[model samples]
Target: MNLALLHDSDFIDHDRVRLTGRRFAHLAGILKVELGDQIPVGQVNGDIGVGRLERLDNDSAELRVTLDTPPPAPLALSLVLAMPRPKMFRRVLQTVSALGVKDIWVINAYKVEKSFWQTPWLADEALSENLSLGLEQARDTLMPQVHLRKRFKPFVEDELPALLQARPGIVAHPGTSTPCPSHINRPATLCIGPEGGFTAYEVDKLVAAGCQAVHLGSRILRVETAVPVLIGRLYDSCAN
Candidate 1:
């Protein structure tokens, strides 16, 4: 863990706080933190801070936290992705968060297997754990918000407009008139389809809803590869 993440409950009544659970093990074993060492720390939705290691025991460690600055602003893009297989899901979540994406919508698609929706990783606790790992790796304090859409049509036709407000929207398809733009400064909502890609009908619906169809390249990419590639390119473009 690059950053030590804490919850409100993790703080003691006093300024002292104890690190237990997974975090304690990580610091002790993985990071091998020593007393007087200052570690990057943050609350789930709170400020970024430094934790001065004051004490350590077999099961827990105590620290003095000095919260100072807020975390940097989140990425300007939100991702709409068709749910991938369970094994790929964890990596995708981590990659997106590490890239600073703060909002995600995982939706059903024609090529998506129905059993994918049954994955236990979709549960809140599991999802949070995966996302937290990414945040810690990136030294980011804020957790991304995740939304699941079981029905595709209503989400695209009805709910997507509000999210699209003030943001450019693109639907990633294999073949389209326009290639996906390299870097975008303004906030954008990007939709990526399933393995075989979105059905023509789905594409039509999305296009009608004000989403422009764009392609990454002629060759198809797995969701995991495509997501980070697209996000990184967009981030670089925005930065330049």
Candidate 2:
């Protein structure tokens, strides 16, 4: 973990926090920190700063926290993705969070297996777990919001129109003639399809809703890989 993420409950006082469980282990076992070591820390959905280790024991540790810096700026983009396979979903969640994407829409598509929705990783606790890992990895504190849409037509015809007002939607399709726009550096809604990709009919519906389909190149990429590539391409903040 790049940052020790402290939840609100971890705070014993305004400037002190009690660490236990994974965080405590990270301090006691991994870092092997002592009484005076200062570590990078952040409050969830709050601020990024440092925590000075004060007390250490097998059960827990206490740190003096002083938060003065804000978290990284969030990407001005909304990711609308067809729900990925369960294994890929967890990685995708982390990747999205690490990239500073604050909005996520997981929609249904023709090729998406019904069983994919049954994964426990989509549960509240699991969602928070992966998102936390992502945030800590990036040393970012702002959490991304995940929206689940089980149906395609309703989401496209009803909800998508309203979302389009914020920015023009860009749909990633493998065979699209137009190359994906690079360094867009503006608010945008990105629509990614399923493993086998959205059917032609679904693509048309997204287009009708004001999304322009674009392509990365001749090669196709897995959801986990494509997400970062696409985000890096679209946002200057991600470009190295």
Candidate 3:
């Protein structure tokens, strides 16, 4: 973990935090940090800073923290994704969060397996853990919000229009004539489909909901590969 992400529960007082579980193990075993050492730390949805280790033991560790630096700027992009395979879901979640995508919509698509939604990774606790991993990797503190929509048509017809009102939308399709625009550097909503791509009717619905259909050349990419590539194409950089 590049940054130790602090949750409210980690705090014993305004300035002190107690670390345990995976975090403690990492510090104790992997990092092998000594007492009095300062480590990078950030509070969830709060500021970035440092924590000076004041106490340590096999069971836990204590640190006095000071938060002042701001986290990296969040991407001005919203991701609307068709549910991906269970095996790839966790990685995708972490990838998006690390890339600073604050808004996410996981909607159903024709090619998406119904079984994909049954994955434990979609559970609230699992979601938080994966997102935290992403934040820790990016050294960011702001938590990204993941929205699940089981019904594709309803979401597109009802909710998506409103989301697109503020950030104009784009949909990534493999063979579309319009190539995905590069470095738009503005707030945008991007819709990506399932493994085999969205069926024509579903693409039509999304297009009707204000998403311009675009493509990433002739390459057919897996959902996991496509997500980061598309985001990189749309924005100047995640740190921006």
Candidate 4:
């Protein structure tokens, strides 16, 4: 973890926070930090700064914090994704969060297995934990929002249009004529289907809802592999 991300619950007072569980283990066992040593820290969705270790032991550690730095700039993008396989889903969540995608839609697609939704990784706590890990990896504090839409029709028809109003949308299809646009400065809502790609009918619905169908050249990428490449293609380098 590049930054020790503290939640509101971690604070004992305005300036002090107590770290425990995974965070404590990381500092005590891996980092081997000493009192008066300063470590990078940030309050979730708040500020980035440093925490000077005021007290420490095996059980827990306390630090006095001063937050002044701003969090990294968020991506000017939203993601509409098909739920991935259970094992890959966790990594995808972390990847997107680290890339600064603040808005996400986990939707159903024709090729997506029903069992994919049954994964424990989609549980509230698990989602939060993985997202936290991603934020820490990026040294960012702003939490990304994940929305689950099990029924594809209603979401693509009823809800997606509104989101597309602010951010013009696109869906990644393997054989589409249009190449996925590069370094798009405007905020966008991007859609990616399951491993086999979205069926013709599904693509039509998204198109009707304002998403342009596009492709990433000749390669057919797995959901996990495609995400970062698409994100990088769509946005400029993130500012530190």
Task: Look at candidate 2 and tell me the lDDT of residue 220.
Answer: 91
Question: For candidate 2, what is the TM-score?
Answer: 0.98
* Per-residue lDDT of 90 in model 3: 91
Candidate 2 residue-wise lDDT at 69:
97
Candidate 2 backbone collisions, by pair: none
TM-score of candidate 4 against the unseen true structure: 0.97
lDDT to native, each model: 0.89, 0.93, 0.93, 0.93
TM-score of each: 0.95, 0.98, 0.98, 0.97
Better of 1 and 3 by lDDT: 3
Question: Which lDDT value does model 2 have at 12?
Answer: 89
Of candidate 4, the 10-residue stretch with the lowest lDDT total is 231-240
RMSD in order of candidates: 1.6, 0.9, 1.1, 1.3
Q: Kindly list the per-residue Cα lDDT of model 2 for residues 1-240, writing each as its tens digit.
A: 999998989988999999998889988998999998999999999988999999998789999998999999998998999999998999999989999998999999999999999999999899998999899999999989999999999999999988889687999999989999998899999999999899999999999999999999999999889999999999889987
Which stretches in model 3 have alpha-carbon errors above 4 Å?
Answer: none
